[model samples]
Target chain A: MNVAANEKEVKIDTAYPYRTLSYFVEDPPTGNRVDRFLEAFAVVLQYTDYKSLLDSYCTTNNKCNRCAVSCPVYQVTGNPRDIPCYRTNLLLEVYKRYFSIGGWFKSRLSSGIELTEELIDEMAEVFYRCTACRKCSMECPMGVDHGLVTRLGRYILSLIGISSKALKVSVREQLEGETHNTSKVPKVALLNTLDFLSEELNDMFGVKLDFPVDKSNREYVFFCAVSDYLMEPDTLMGNAIVLYAAGDWDKWTIGTQNYDGINYGLFYSDWHLERIIQQLVQEVTRLKGRNILIGECGHASRSAHDFVPMFGGKEAYPVVSFIEYTLNCLQNGKIKLNPDIVTERVTYHDPCNMARSGWIVEQPRTILKSFVRDFVDMEPKGRANYCCGGGGGLVSIDEIHDFRMEIAGKIKAEQIAATGAEIVIAPCANCKKQLKELVEYYDLPCKVMGLHDLILTAIEIPNGKSAVERKEEAEMFAM
Target chain B: MDAWIEFAKGPLFAVSFLIMILGLGRHLFLQLDGLVRRKGRRLLKAPWRKIFTDSLSWVIPVRHIVDVHRTVLFSVSSYIFHIGVIVVPLFLADHIILWERLLGFHLPKIGTLLADVLTVITIACLLTLLGCRLFVERQRGVSRVSDYVLLVAVLIPFLSGFLASQPQLNPISWRAMFLIHLLSAELLFVLIPFTKLAHIVLFFFDRISQVHWQLRPGAGDMVSETLYGKEAKV
Candidate 1:
């Protein structure tokens, strides 16, 4: 584990173009001892053990570039180092130097290369550059899960305190703060936001809508991204209106503490992901809810619906997307939409978590079609859709906003422009944020809206009062 | 010359075959061992079913090749080269004769003309692939010395065999051409298990692992409970 002691003899291979020192800036030592970092790397490798697949990926004759060709980031950047396989190799090279059979032989032949701090910095930079969208995994011939590799790389980097400040702060807030939300919206603030949303909905639709909080024994424990409380109240109002119209008003309630479904842990650290999901499961179980209905956030829904069970074991309740719930309501004739209300040319952006992981691709489209007069599909819609460049917590990192806009977000901007749609329906919260930024930065003639936003505009909410009462009120008004 | 040919066809061939078998067996065994060790409390419901379907899907070029625009040409050329290499070597009269002589079993053979045409096509495809690796900017960035060496190793046998089969087109004496062909083929057999060529057998292992890892049941619920303690009651 004396990795740093042997660092003096480490020879940087200048022959390799990417190994140049110019691409990286050396940071002062931050108490991350080389021995401890090596231990963490070994532990992660043993936990995942992707050696055979990685070996084949690097050595196979085809050197399959399917992941690279399909990767939206790489497609936009055109940097060979950004290729998913190449990025994975950065970790593989470390594994080969210290732990592999070849490394054992090579160590005997020469003082082998040490995993340097600079190399770790480069790994951190490249791994974070990726969105962890898993679109690359879908196309890889060997099924080398690049998403897993990226997350693991980030996890290892996190051990040495090499993660983004933005993501770290969010996780800290959720775990340590009393509010238990990433945005740190307090309980009273959340209730006030809900009350404001109810007022807004009544003003617009002439119907009373209430957002139930902390009620027990509901059929579903609804969770939305915490940012919705302040940034997107319309979306929250849309959720309430749809739920009330669908006759599920009494069937669902939002938890007071664990209402926010945004899980930034899925972006970097496995430790954080597990803790967040456990808290989510505990909230649902405590409420005596029969099901967990995750609202219109891609990674949140994915974390809750897909990874929660994996981390928490089988839950008493089933986890579902609010999109699926709406689709069911539409199918059952409990709710109806007036298509003329949304006459603009609309297109859908498939959040990678929903389309690729959750298989919630068609459900959003179904909901959109039910309300929109003109619905267009992106050229490569569904699972193959390009990332909004803000996934993997990149949207939260303000320092890299330009990097996202000029590079990672480029392909998505182009994809949206190609469709020539005026309205882009991003069902996931993360996608909406990225898409909105892309529209602003690229100056595209399109506006970003949430699926629930569209639903609020077109949904037909029935007046709860009886017809006789309404007629008597009208007669009284005439008198 | 006769002595060299005799050794090439006898001891050299046997030694190479033995190394290839043991090497491939060890490689596949280690991969399977890794798979078993990594299974850890995770349910692989219908693993065999997943492995079979995934293997079948990957073997066909349609999904992996034709559907992806960037890989269509490379995948098509690879498919053609792989078919020619496997089919020509196994079904040619000369190879079947050797197999029958060694193992006392013979299979039906393709016509000599067809075998020759396929061998030529395979060599051409291999050369094209080599060119792509050398010339394609992105591919060149990832290409290593082993990649070039492996391609040359595969190409020598096919090129020499083609020349040996048609003595009229031979660039040297018949005995020399035949020896070069035999020696190169033997070299490939020895190298297959140690080099990237191991992918031939390891492809199944990689694909199966990928499919099973993706399909691992309860992936949604199997928290790294060790990392996070028991769920706290709200």
Candidate 2:
């Protein structure tokens, strides 16, 4: 599946800095300071942590400005002040004016002009425009994390009531609802999805398997996003087949009630985050599950791997990413996959949530290599991987699509072109959706396949089932 | 005359050297105090391997020197300036006379004509570089007023050396070159503390900032807990 056109360098628009700047200027921090002792400390420590970051990473006025020029957001807006360099300078000015000797001398000279509410408002605007993707961190002579810096700045902004509406709503829902703003999904919808997946699997491969949803007391529990079930049913079906191929059909059950693994709590408030994850852990424990496997979602994986250990409070149980667990099963002969199932030339996109935040880089590659023969690697991969433009809730704001596609996907489009691989194996839900938009906009010929979909396609079934049989099984169960 | 040049040169070099050391020492002391008070442990404890191995790391032990790209013009200019600075003082016949008086030994002159030609070219390049820096838009944007002043400070030494080295310009070569070159270099030494050129002192602050954070026990979990609490179900 060779692409007809090469989208090697998609140009990002550098307009709209004023709008971004204005938004930051006007918007007050949205969520309340979470009650958790650690969170309060984390929120309070944001000021010192940010200063430490600057002191450690950006002390040089000369060397640390690489982020100002090369940043995608800055490139899009053409505003130096909104970028990390000047944003940092804003903080440094605060440090000096309020804290340093030069600041004291200048104050004495100027009759003591203190940092006011107006200053905080302007600085907040400058700070939040950054998505904190850490792309500029790659170019800095000092490996400074502007992403963490921006996040801390945004957190501080939240304390002052100046956060984005989309982010705020998402945070509110996660905090109160213990779900990522997704409505309470109908059990029938999930059951229908499982039935559909079962029929698809039967049609594609001559294997009859049950993908049970919300079954109590299962030995193994699998969690997936509700969005995957609705929009990307194949992602769900793919996971079903992988589980089946791994010979865990009898042991595993998919949760029917609000199976979304995405924790919006991670984005805004830490309090709701703990509540959400603890509930998930409780569900697993109540079911008496031996192992819990998370589906192909980036933020979800971050919740499981990063947030779970910290906030989950106890050594709950064994929790693993679907990719890792499936790969292990395949290696140990628990699951057998045919090479012909995934014959296309494919490349992997490392999700920011999994790659940068979770550090789950190698497992997906190992899984892909076992199934994909012509597996190619994109340059600037691993921890240095670019965002899919959808991770930080940017894709939800439909108005920013044009800029987001051009700016965020610009580098990703180049990485895809460099590979020349026919299929892109992005194991993330948001990354998959964004790539779909990119492939359409840029006219790239490659088909975007979720990691689960490819796994389902290649997994060796018990009977001699064709691809149609598996699809039938999936559809049948889904219905 | 030899004894007089020797006596003047020794005091001039000593004064200039002492000023540079004192300026650097005070700058470092302040930075250390700030580091301690601010708790810049990551930068303080940064390992050498982490400094060199990072993709974005450019190791400059000194701070005030500016970037390699931005400083290319100045560096190239300084090459010529430095040649004049060192050779004019060390290789010139008058300089040798002062050295002979001070150390009681006179080394052979390789080629006085070639030496004179090199000094002239070095001084000319140095002047040209300084002129361009003042005029160029990209250079001027980042340049402070003191940057031009430093360039002139550097240029005076070369200009005086060139004038002193020529046969026709030689009547007052010893005193004029010695006085102008020594005074200009000394003036730069004084101005360094007040100028952006003090990055020499600031470079250590920048390098100290370059120290990478090695993930400590509980640090990763602590960050996660703070960002996303344990019970977050989304």
Candidate 3:
């Protein structure tokens, strides 16, 4: 069956299913080249030409075997059938068979293997073997999008009622409002987060911070990843220090409705992603905050930057990241750093989102370097840098721990090792957490700290509003 | 035979020069356009296109063609190939003379010794590339008919030029060699945009795409591959 017809039957019952847009239908016009090929081949469909033979064989990720060197999966497995380049070549052969005379007659006359269930399963395995990491994307010179091609293949698999278990469950949960996304916080967790923030800020900056939770109708609404509340207590507290130091405490309030900064639905489908964003944007609007300051999370920031602009269009809200706010405050002379607190061989691990994905790479680098004494750069710094392996929902996949470490973590470890820096400051919580595990696994000496941790060590709390002041502030808000 | 030599020296050289400049201009323009526009897929999309585009920027698309060591060696050879790709075609006196004939333009030559040195370097680079392709493990496994065809296409011109420059070989041999070289060079030129060669133009484009994606609000929307929630994009 054609790809379109096959995709309609796809079912997502897994943890992360490929959620097709049940709400909106789009006939993603097949690409320019594919359309031309179809039109040209239509004339000789029954003529037993290469057009027919090649068209039949141009199946996605089914194994025509052309990519010889750079496919990361094939690089790991040494299997031709598993590589994406091979699939590309298979399609190329179809192009060659009809257009290039030599390939045409031979392919048309040959009796090729028919598309069977076993063949489909094998193709799926080959397609799934790829992490969609984009290493091969850097290697292939044709600008062939192997990852997207694979996604298309995966989407096709979904249509055939063979969607993965993980994809289905995750999509379903997201749709049903069971989105335990990065920002989703339970009552106890929210309370604990506030308490921790209060303690950390007081202890470090001597600022008694009153971080209010679920306080509706404030001028500024701050959103943070739930993990930041639990693990990176310093970040929450650091934010409190800035707010308290800036004396904008009453103007800023945490959302009583949703604290999760992430919009994971963006990866699975477009419309569902739009809904969550609309809801968040609407909530922030209703809160009537002059500005929405997103905490140190990459993808969350990305969702705001990309989707908010798209969805909000002309009336887009001014959503700013903490880093941006910090830089702005520093630039405007709103805050000053105590140089005595800044002493370390520190190098910023530009979170893939903040640096490459968010265009906030330079600000953090400049800010970190300005505040720190010994600032060094990672070898493949910035956009060219490798992933933390634990990114994308892979960090939560504990069942596949061995695979994650072996495949993804290994590449990251090597990249980190090449950096030869002392401390790798990861601004995002996910990167920080993943790097923490990988550092321990590889026995690396580098310490992974949140971006605010360094800031916390530096910026001094205003007089009379020290740690005690911060603690008093927290108590007042919590009460 | 002399007429063909004269024409090759004059007309063919000029035409080839024009094609190179035009190709280079188009290539560079496309590269800049790709950077500013930043219209490329993400890791979850078609990765090969990204791979292909990125690979071209470094002037080497397929790194797996050689072992890590061999890759370094091949890159070094590629630098030599680049020098030859430029000098032997654009700066040779014969080429200049040909251009002068075709377009009435006279490009200065760097001298005979430099030309001879460049030819030798170019030949050595080609030989090195060929050696790496044949001997490298990953390259050997993936090598196809097209790969061999590209190699021959390069070698024919270099060999013809070397023979043509020699006083011992007949002028006919030189003429025949030049024709073969012209044909091969033209084939390589025409094939560039359609084949993986376009990556040379697309790499910069991909880099810009990376820059653009990094700046978006959902930049941290990294989906974790692990089953647990810890390593995911939180």
Candidate 4:
């Protein structure tokens, strides 16, 4: 709850661009287009199962406003509109105006407020203000999910093609484009990256390691956030090393057709959510794998773990998070790590998506306790953890770089600064990137990394070779 | 005035009470109908039992007690206010007599002094809550006209009943205060289903979706048991 003193800090209150989210939207909603807005609302009413959800959120006066205390955005900005309840009401007000029985009477009898493009425009701006971390749902006595309402708002807006262009274009390439992934990495590139990682890892450890690819009927099918292939080689390498320790090439394989696991759809649109999940299931079914092992991306893991059933139905495989799989291996004594290494003052950031439901929170913490010498926890960590201000796909947009650091992530920055950690091990790829920016932006004296990145550094090799020895040997060879 | 009071309590009260019950029932049924329609459509079944049990476990609002320095006072006020709203109306000597007359059943009534004390405390709590909304900038900003209306509407009956019970304290005529009390209570009963007050019954369904809906398949009993200790407790 303590923020570090900054001479150049942007005040969240009474500041224009700091409080305001600036996005280059593809079709910026213009005028009071009630007809188009109503059309989309009607479609949402028919398709989405949010009628019951919006009912409680719209109807309830559970207005204790305690969620403001829980919301990092509201806390930093001191803006009433930034409150989670207020944000949810932005959508619920629309729902009440058009859909509800009370709204039916009120529209004719009372103020006669109808859905307008102006409200939708406000929804577009405000919905993104939240990281959609969902720490707020914990405080609402009515348990109205503010995050779900945000998603529902985004979903309806997406129907009108009014979502973030960053999310839109990436999703475009993922679903319909030639290379069906958000990063648009070609098959050759994915394979080459893995091949190069295998070579790099093998040369360091003096052990032959080939990344299993395109193998049929394997026990585990790996689907990582494609960005991990390029940006986080160590996370992929750690997972590969851990999985190999658990079994071998016979046990796991990455599919050639669609190995990318990122589904930004989880953040915004149900159309994309279902489509991406169906595609992920197809890739798994193509390989006939026994289980789905998702790599170090929180939303990616959540989409597979939770939405697979919602979207895939019969094609749903047992989705295991990379952390969970690695934890299982550690628990089973399949893998070992040297405990004395990674001596820095370390802390973990709970990816709001994974930590919200108590899914991946304790697993990573438990894994960290095994190796980390002085691992500290944020004051209100796990389930109640503040987001890195990069959730809900806010990290992907370069335009909001300062916003993500100065205001959106201010609370998280303070949480880290309070712990005085030299290293922050955020397991999610998005979290790591945002926290890295946060460390740089705020000048927090720390380094940001993935949990598996540490595991890669500390993991004991099978052939009696320690990673320390390998690092020394590589350093000696370089000399 | 006496006749109007009886009229408000008898036929009018019956009609309004029935509307509240039926309207709220319809809302619950529709919500459940939506959930039911989408239930089997998805692959993994939500841990309904655990979710509901955990939700019921949190009914006392002890979670906020952890932040005692900050939100505890407000949460306690809300907790007591809700209790008083339900308990005072049900167990007050006059109301129990009315219930006995209507239902032909034996009922217990609280002492008038105790009931008065609770009514005062509850009124203060409700005022504290409303004052927070009205005075607090952030709370006022998030609030709608309907929110303010709902709180004042709820307050009128309690205020009128307390004043009527003590004729010395009544600024308005005793019969007039009594009439206002009966009519206001009737108005609340009629409006309950149409407004956010419907959350009285619907909180569970709202809670279930947000709390345990994201639970991975087969992790329900485990997580619930670990978090709340055993799944089947009410």
Candidate 5:
């Protein structure tokens, strides 16, 4: 169906208003799809054996609404089915009908529904609807990790060849293909983009900056969301300026093999997540870098910092977020910032992966406070901040644009509007893209920028050569 | 009727109490066993100190339910109800006298007026919670048959006990009302392990398992330490 048609069908403030059998239906699989799905489900159960835990919350009359009250999607759509507990209950129903001991008794006692394609389709549709933000789990008195359950559901769906086209194309095909990045920018194009960004930096800042690529034996191997190289040149330039000013130019090099740090696998499929992490580990190892520095993307930073050890095992090197690295540089007085560079009121949006996952919360705030003179905070910022409505790879899929803007993004738009900040410093790439779109769609009269972008504006590069001299040197190098 | 009353107060109560203990014990043991098995596969070193501190924080209603979620009215009412449910049953003069007669144990008892007041508040809170489940759209969406049934199960005992204490308000015979109250209480005890009341024990375990359960420092840092054996740093 067309986007507009889908939007028109979705009625707000109703129970399962978007429920249509068409959205759940998929083409028949080639060979014995039911057996394959059940087999995959069995495999997943092996990995996640929390049947008792599920039972604790799944009991009849256990209407623990802690998760429901906190769920952002349910908060927006007002759909009971969208509640995190309800979603988890759907899985629990599946477990009870198929696997649990009590399920055996239930099947015999009642005319129980069989696990069919329709059930799988509904599960896929609902599971993908969630952002897997874990915000619900945070407030849940039972601590039922619905996020993990949703992820497992996605994994099982993928096994049955039921998955989102956007996730498959961007995360699986593109990353596994020759480009090795989600944006599909080839190596040549990447180098050319860097060169073009370098020229732009020279024209704008009148400083000679270099983005080292493929240089070996560096202290830090910088990996950023490849989209940043194309969409947010200023963010890339900001990263370069900070590294160069910190006198870590020789210590850091962007890997030629895997430049993008984004792991869409975290949002959709575990196989994709594992492959992405393995590729990152291989890239860092190939360069023999001391530390893996993930640039301003929340999920990528989190995946690299947390999942790498699980996937990389003994080969896993230390993974640090670019924000943490920058904060460390500032703390050690490795770089200086001109406080008057930005005078506008600035606020920060905590990416769910960073804030909720507890990866790099304070570092960004510390950096933001250093340069932003008129700094303000979004109410319930830090750990309690609302998602940008484009998390969980939702930003990549154009099909859900209206759903994001109207329902999911509603609370976030209000939060940003209430802040009344001139600029919003969203460090995560996904959040930046979402917030930027939100500003345009909501007409909120605020510009969205990366955290490093603000730092770049405020950073005072150490004086070494005059602007004219640097331009002449650049010209000489071009010759 | 006399034989049934004797059975209800003797063998039936003993049987229900046994079921409650064994059923809840098995449930808790299985849960902890799952944790142990999961730890082996995940290679997780338990952060006992942080777990204990986080569990304690949640145990205090002010820190978790009130301060964290800010559902002031619901949380406040829940606290009062829980206090009444626990305090009145153990310390009421009638229950203390019964315990003395049956088990040869005696404890200090609260004044009948105070017990009466506590029971009234407890019953009121139970009704308010039931109303919330029935009327609140979000709560109603998640509510199941068992939820309403469980609430009714709990309410019967409190209501009957309250009526029996206030003879002026009693609509039934004192002996009949008292017998009904004891039977309902025994039914609740038997159902505790099989129903949502398991949360009374599961709450501590669940709170400790959450990602937010960090007391030493930032939750993220603690997660990093647990996952990677070192703090997340450059």
Candidate 6:
């Protein structure tokens, strides 16, 4: 409402702080008109409203900027806009302007803010810049979860069809595509991958290993970021080897439907988040599995484990992370791991989705310390650890490779370097991808892989021949 | 001046106190309302004991010293300011007498010397915070006009109350300072629920929400059917 006759009229709703977020919107929003931005935000707000929480946060945010110290992106970029508090306020201010009583009164009195195309575009860029790590939430005296607000902002923007292409495309596929997985891996391909992995493990360990699929009435149905089959064969094999070694043959099996644990909706859309979790639940239900076992992916484990009872309703299966299951197995003497295999100095990178809330923090550390002889903790390890910079699904976006490397992932690169470790083990599939990129980009002398990737190397499986024995047998047998 | 001071301390004080109570009560209600999920069963397995103890850590004035070893001087000062501002007004002899008259009960009074020391400490902390908002480049960049205005709004009552208590310390007329102190505090009371000052009540809720992120199972299930598309639920 620029109803001003002269330029001298004070526009109270003038985009004071957020007007500066005039960056490029990666995925274009649906509506062309600027006013449509507000309508979309309103629709999303009503659809997934946390009014009391948003109202308090919007009312109480003092712009302390303390969160900047904890923000990996803000620390490297040194920009006010990158600050978690500022990023969160991008939505909070909108909440105030459009939803709150005081802002309504003030807006009615004066020229209030118009949700502009530029503002929506600004949000499109700002929200993605955050890894949604939730580290900043630790330092906030007001207890505002800046990452949660960023998620809310992203959800609103996605409603207007402005989310990152990487996240949107994958989520769209997972929702509507025949494969029902983010990576679009068909059941046949997944089974083939399992068969290939079984042969590889058999050759490596001189032991017969089977990657069980679609097996019914198992004690646990496993799900990991499905892309693991494409890139993380060792991790998948490690999971199979560990579960097979730790329990009886029928203890765990991978289901065909909803086998992929990567829930991109957790980053940008509540609608997707719920439905994706439902897929995982349906898979477990279909298998008649008693428990859900989420593999090395952080958000996959968290979203599945935390929300299963909610989405599953009367049939809430007990959900466990791979780390927790392995830790339990190790403690119970269910499996043995050789610590001597890892002599190189190693450090654990706490994935934000897993460790930020202390859900899967200690279990991984316990598992790592068990087999990792030279394990060293990062300066701010565990719940306070910095993001791998490619968090919140940014790792999936190849376009922001430079932004991820130099700015967003900068702190993580340095954190890895500071550890001076040869191998940096990140448990989450998302974190593993980001850290590998960070190491390569930053020119650090560290190799990145999953926790299970190393575990597979050191695990002592029954009927598994020693490496030396297997090598000698290969020469003698002349196969 | 005598009549104005009496009016400020008696009826104005009561009305202001009522507004402050009702306003904070309403704010407290809103915050509690936000915590409730209508569509699903609230998970009883949240580590509430741990969450409560962890949240209590935020209230300790110097927890930064123990938590980060950095003592984040800004927060420590803000904490002291918060503690002092609340404690001084409640336990100061004059305020206790007013409370006694108004509510038929009073908190245990602090010695005049101790009260004076706390008031000065609170004022100094306020100044330190003000300086931080003004001088610290990062904080100043984020600071709004309302930030400075609110600091001054809080300062008026404290500065005036200290001056009003001892006539010898008062540069302005003691009666005038007394009236200003009473009026400014009342004004702050009215503004509490609307401004950043709302944090005085909402901070606990904020902490709870933070812990709530690692939610108990299906905490968000209520919105499954009722919230967006009915077909949205699989």
Largest DockQ belongs to which candidate?
A: 6
lDDT of each residue in A1-479, candidate 3, tens digit only: 00011122323222222233211122222234343333323322222112222322232111112243433335444554545666444334445555545355566788543333443444444444454444444443233445434433443343333334444444444335444444345666787667776776556555567677656667667877656876787777667777776667887888756666766544433334555576667667766666677898876786776667655544467788988888877777777666655555887776666664456878888778776877887755675455676554455445444444555566666666666667788878767777888777777768888777777657755674433344456568789
Weakest lDDT window of 10 consecutive positions for candidate 1 chain A: A1-10
**Native interface contact recovery, all models:** 0.23, 0.05, 0.03, 0.38, 0.26, 0.46
lDDT for A196 (candidate 3)? 71
CAPRI quality level assigned to candidate 6 from its DockQ score:
acceptable
Per-residue lDDT of model 4, residues A1-479, tens digit only:
46654676554333333323477678665665567667777666654455666776677746678888778888777888788888887777777877877788877887866565556667778887778888787777777778887887776676665778888889888888889899999999988998899887887666778888899999899988899988999888888888766666579999988888998988886657767888899989999998998989889988888778655667878888889888888998988888877779999999987887537878999899998999899878887788999999999987777678877898899999999999999888899899988888778899998888889878887774687886577569889
Q: Write the per-residue lDDT of candidate 2 for residues B70-164, one digit (tens) a residue.
A: 44455455545556655665677766875676568996554677677777777677676666656654444344444566667766766676665
RMSD of each: 7.8, 8.6, 11.3, 6.9, 6.9, 7.0
Task: Compose the digit string of candidate 6's lDDT tens values, residues B97-213.
Answer: 888998898689989998888889999989988888888777787788889999999999999989888788799887778788889999998888778898888877777775344
Cα lDDT, model 2, residue A215? 70
Q: By how many angstroms RMSD does model 1 differ from the true structure?
A: 7.8
Best by lDDT: 4
Residue A345's lDDT within candidate 3 is: 80
Q: Which portions of model 5 miss their true places by more than 4 Å? A: A1-36, A111-116, A204-206, A464-479, B41-57, B60-72, B89-114, B211-234
Which residue pairs does candidate 5 place in steric collision?
A61-B147, A358-B220
User: What is candidate 1's TM-score against the reference?
Assistant: 0.87
lDDT score, candidate 1, position A116: 76
Per-residue alpha-carbon lDDT of candidate 6 for residues A1-479, written as tens digits (9 for 90 to 100)? 01111222222211434553322344454557455566666555454446667888887898877787677787766777788888787788888988878888989898867667767766777887888888788778787888888887877666555677777778878888889888899988998898899898888787777767788999888888999989999898888878878875578888887788899877877767877878777878888899988889988877876677656677789988888888898999998988777778999999888886548778888888887889998878888788888888888988777777777777777777788899999988888888887777657788998988888878887787753454456568885
For all candidates, state DockQ relative to the true structure.
Answer: 0.32, 0.09, 0.10, 0.24, 0.23, 0.46
Q: What is the TM-score of chain A in candidate 6?
A: 0.91
Task: Indicate the DockQ of the complex predicted as candidate 4.
Answer: 0.24
Report, for every candidate in turn, its global Cα lDDT versus the true structure: 0.76, 0.61, 0.56, 0.79, 0.74, 0.77
Worst 10 residues of 4 chain A by lDDT: A11-20
| Per-model TM values vs. the true structure | 0.87, 0.66, 0.66, 0.91, 0.86, 0.91
Q: Write the per-residue lDDT of candidate 5 for residues B1-234, one digit (tens) a residue.
A: 677788888888888878888878877887777666654444352445544554565556474464346345555666688889888988998889766865688888999889989999999998888887787788888777778898899899999999988899999898899899989989998998877787767665565554211111122233323333563221
